[model samples]
Target: MSAGPTSFCGIELAHPIINASGTFDAIAARRAFGDAVVERFPFSAYVSKTITPAPRAGNPPPRLWEEPAAMVNSIGLPNKGAEGFLSTDLPALADLPVPLIVSVMATSAEEFSGLVEAVSARDEVAAIELNVSCPNVHSGLIVGEQPSETEALLEALRPLTAKPLIVKLTPNVAAPASVAAGAEAGGADAVSLINTLKARPMFAGKPWLGAGSGGLSGPAVRAVALQQVSDVAAAVSIPIAGMGGVESGSHARDLLDVGAEVVAVGTASFRDPLAAERILIELRGLDPVAASSATSEL
Candidate 1:
């Protein structure tokens, strides 16, 4: 019973299972599985892939490289851009059964501001998830890597809309808790974390991925995510949507034990598109209240 409902940043959800941006595609899912997929959607909220101000073809080639416990991706945030997203993508996504969170990224503050303003204006958007992986030109640092940069970006965009602002944090930083604290200081409603670890693999004296390095994800990073989630949860009072190596209900519960209000399935979905549903079912079968206190996080 404890698993049936929850509220996140003012939006009601059937459950806390959500997919990582770029991991699950609802429009494509509906195309492949039909309307039933929408009626029985796995996630309570649908997060669109990161869209920039203009269209991008993505990296040159060989963007994905599989590893023992995970995979690396340099696929880049290939998308149809802001204008294309609002016109072409938003219409179809609006038909989903749950709330829609648009994920956006830009090279500059003004560009990011434009994205937040445009997406927030849409009737279909429930919230905006700012992917902080972008580099800050003024500080010569990536937004997720620097606490000050994250705070400044959030400060600039917070006034644009009343919708919830969920900052997606990168796991590359030494102390992600600081970034989460900064995000909170700048008025973020919540935070989704452990975007991926920077990694590179080589084979036969050459890099495996077409791009020399990429972000690593999957089961291997779960421990790292748990630690960071625990740290960030301790650092900020706002809700947290924890994600990294989530594959099953037990894994989701683990994140919840560490104080994540929600858990996102990433690499596991590539293997089983319906993994989220299975995870949700498993999660519901357990006692959510009993599980929440199973661990004392670091």
Candidate 2:
């Protein structure tokens, strides 16, 4: 048996099965599923969706489209933003069974740093997962696409944050592993990845998603996720939070085997909100109870 508890950035997780941010909405989900949802929170830690400086209505209509064995989304990180997140959302999610990692994004490095400082002050926030995959409005360079940009962004925010800084990398890059290395060079405590492959869906001879392009996620991306995690883990010294298409215990274990420290369930939660819990149960079954209860003849 592994000697230590499944953890990420020193936060002990009851299990490695954590819900991917944007995929699981704890408060809304609880309201929908009631006690059933509360019974199995479906994650070792809860990650809030991307928060910005102010509220957003999100992209126009038709933000989601279904494809075979996967889903495409251009929801555009629609959220209540920082002030509303702290005042309204955090309080409600304060009682999650595990730590709360807040995911944040912005248009510039300074904005990213500001968001980090704001969320870092919260008592319930365990860590800050910086979404650097988005295109930077100021320079038009995705921080995750260029190693230098990622390094600079991390360097700017690292000093402002005491909590673990997790840089979420975009899979749309030519070499995500090199980007992950850049994050580590700038003092990122950990990294999470395969943040949705850039994709588009078509139906009835028309674009299926409102934005014409969305991040593709689900079972279809699992193999790519595994490879990226493996490459990043080999390239960096920090822990990797492997995510993308993990939907079951075997899938989670496959990630761990590939050097992922924690497995994040994304699209699976959309289909079965209880998938994380089910994965945890399956992981628990891998070790016999006797491993910890072997009788020693004195």
Q: Pick the candidate with the highest lDDT.
A: 1
Q: After superposition, how far is residue 140 of candidate 2 from its true place, in Å?
A: 1.2
Q: Model 1: per-residue lDDT, tens digit, 27-130?
A: 88899999988877888899899999999888867899888999999998899999999999999999998899999999889999999999999989999999
| lDDT by candidate, in order shown | 0.89, 0.84
lDDT of 2: 0.84
Show the lowest summed lDDT stretch of 10 residues, model 2. 289-298
Counting clashing residue pairs in each candidate, in order, gives: 0, 0
Candidates' RMSD to native: 4.3, 3.6
Q: How close is candidate 2 to the true structure, as a TM-score?
A: 0.93
Which candidate has the highest TM-score of all?
1
| Superposition error at 231 for model 2 (Å) | 0.5
